[model samples]
Target: MTAKYPNKEHVTYATFLSSNRREKVDGVEIGTQFTKVVVNHPLQENEELVRPMKHCKTIGDVHSEGTSIAWPSICIQKING
Candidate 1:
């Protein structure tokens, strides 16, 4: 898909709901934890496949990774504490 924000980066939400071809004692198959971010909005058919989002909260590890500014002290405290 193409869009105005083709270069803008963001995260999308997806879930592994079911597996059709798998043999288990309980007849259940575990799915994947992989989530892919789409540069453009997902198609109509992919709407139910994943939940898309524009943003998410930053975590505390950002500072430990050697970044000058992760977030404000108060913001980090509010999130981490």
Candidate 2:
């Protein structure tokens, strides 16, 4: 997928499934399964810093307008072992 910035700069992202498995059923209980994926060349700090305004492109302007915005990208990703 390609992400286009407000300045018209495009960034390509490639995702790969590192590992995946089906859930196994034990007796009458059902187990949960998950897939582990890795995104090649994920965005870095420098990239964000260089384009801080790019981050706000989606929400447009928010100058004390009392408008609520949802920024899913800002959510933190948790790693499990």
Candidate 3:
């Protein structure tokens, strides 16, 4: 591997969703994964997204590990308690 990438530090990797393999017992999968350091913005045609953005909200909106940010795009009603 060193021969192919002697200076790997110079490599600027973009969002890639190739860490996990596509495996489905019945072809139904959903939810988000905060474990990935790099998340593919525009999912490819042949790629499978195990996690969906909608499910993330129900799970505390954890887009990534060690970080938590409010989803401003959602229409949240401000009800005074």
> How does each model score on lDDT?
0.21, 0.26, 0.24
Q: Per-residue alpha-carbon lDDT of model 1 for 1-81, expressed as tens digits?
A: 111223222222122222232312122222232212122222222221122222322212221232111111111111122
Candidate 3 lDDT, 1-81, residue by residue in tens:
001122222111123222232322123221232222232122222222233343342222232322222211111122244
Model 1's lDDT to the true fold?
0.21
Provide the global lDDT of candidate 2 against the true structure.
0.26
Estimate, for each residue in 1-81, the C-alpha lDDT of model 2 and write its tens digit.
123223433332223232223322111111122222223433431233112232232222311222222211222234455
Ranking by TM-score: 2, 3, 1
| Deviating ranges (above 4 Å) for candidate 1 | 1-32, 39-41, 49-81
Q: Residue 26's C-alpha lDDT in candidate 3?
A: 21
**Total clashing pairs for each candidate:** 0, 0, 2
Model 3 TM: 0.18
Write out the backbone clash pairs for model 3.
Answer: 31-51, 31-52
Any runs in candidate 2 off by more than 4 Å, and if so which? 1-14, 22-33, 45-81
Candidate 3 Cα outliers beyond 4 Å, as residue runs? 1-67
lDDT of 3: 0.24
The candidate that achieves the highest lDDT relative to the unseen native structure: 2
